[model samples]
Target: MNWSWLGPPMDVRPLFPVERGAFLDLLNTLTAEDWERATVCPGWAVRDIAGHVLHDQVRRLSADRDGHPGPAFEPGEALPGYLARTNEDFVRTARQLSPRLLVGLLDRLGQELDAMWAGRDLHAPAGLDVSWADPGAPAPTWLDVAREYTEYWVHQQQIRDAVGRPGADGPRLLRPVIDAFLRALPHTLRDAAAAPGTAVTVTVPGPAGGRWTAVRGAERWGLAPAVPDGGRAAAEVELAADTLWRLASRGIEPAVARTRARLRGDEALTGAVLDIVSIIR
Candidate 1:
């Protein structure tokens, strides 16, 4: 079978500046009270989410634009633990800054990121691997940037959810987030045993929804955009776009999300899809 279709490059080049502008607009509208409200991220308030996004922006510019390396991991530090510690450290320290300063820095740094992204070749090797999606190799620049876009968007959504101001669920913003998260399917299903050519399909239904199928190869599973061979599969799952994103990001627990998922065919393959967590934590 031709495996080239797996994990196709998504050139979300124009989305960087647009997403940044929306993020800034969202942040500017928050009241001081809104900043203190709790979000879905456990023990993290709206202010912490804002601070986290700012850290993300700074880290990207430092690592990719300025060629500065990130902090070294402690000996025997796993990726998730190290990332969580660093993120919490940043958020804890960032509390000293006023909201106005945070917005101003984000506005300026976002412009820098937009400019840096505009000049890069999408097909070039990424500065960091999107380890959740494809740990075996460095991703293309497009996928890396798309993941960044999702980070900003997801944080913005958290803030919105906290403040009771819900916007930015449009297909343009959310569709890409869902698409990028689905890239984790192959890795999510890596341990599920299936014969060569066995297909597991996942479908998210809505304006921002799409279908992806992961086919068992000789040594691994490979994900492709569309279903294969008359849309048949050994397993298939249908879920809403909101559930899929939250499910893949650990924003919602597997048992809770499974309540929303409609499963058919093989139970094991469908269960594997439900267990997907696209982020490091």
Candidate 2:
């Protein structure tokens, strides 16, 4: 399917189909040589990343169908460690395949994921637990759906970055990914108590961007609309759209993003924002 990666990012709520199509279109354009090119992910070439994406989709789909957790990892394992090891194992298994075969798998698995999501409800409790969200607790169904789209978009962006393709910028595509990524922020700050009403506002600067304030409530921090109609933030972090997405996804270095970012207010809160990562490791 030939689709334009250009124009504004789409307003794809409960995002699917559109971004999935876009990812597939971009995947189709990768030349054999392009697939061999190195992406920002260390030790993973463009083709390996594609394999990783496909592997994740297939695994998640299978888990959903089984309606139970897959074989358990050791308890008390950190989220990033679990993801990195799991992803590495999957990528290693797919490493011997020809780029053509791997690409074909991406297409097939994408269709499977799309079909699996179609029959599912977006508002009910999702079947899986998002470890990043409350450490083994079940996240809301909408959050799970949002994370799925963000996964596809970010992986596709990695390929685009490797091959010098552009056009996933702006709010339509990024806003959802950014919002979904930020869901972990409250969890990240769950223990870092602030005064009852203190807040932290994360601002991504661009047309497809927004400001979200996470105010510390009695027991935890939670996200609210950016406009401080509620109260002033104790800390505000402003980063360009690209930088924030990259950092949140662990696609960029925290130090680097912080250097390029405009930080105001509380230092500790800003530090937590910098350390916020949606990806495992």
- For residues 94-212, could you state the per-residue lDDT of candidate 2 as single tens digits? 88888777767777777777777777665566756655555565555666777778888998899999999986655777778876777777776776758877778888777867776
Judging by lDDT against the true structure, name the best candidate: 1
Provide TM-scores for the models: 0.94, 0.85
**Candidate no. 2 TM-score:** 0.85
Instruction: Give the Cα lDDT of each candidate.
Output: 0.85, 0.74
Query: On a 0 to 1 TM-score scale, where does candidate 1 land against the true structure?
Result: 0.94
Instruction: List, residue by residue over 97-215, the lDDT tens digit for candidate 1.
Output: 89999999888988888889899988888856788877857777887888888888888888888888888888988899999898888889999988988898888888898888888
What value of lDDT does candidate 1 attain over all alpha carbons?
0.85
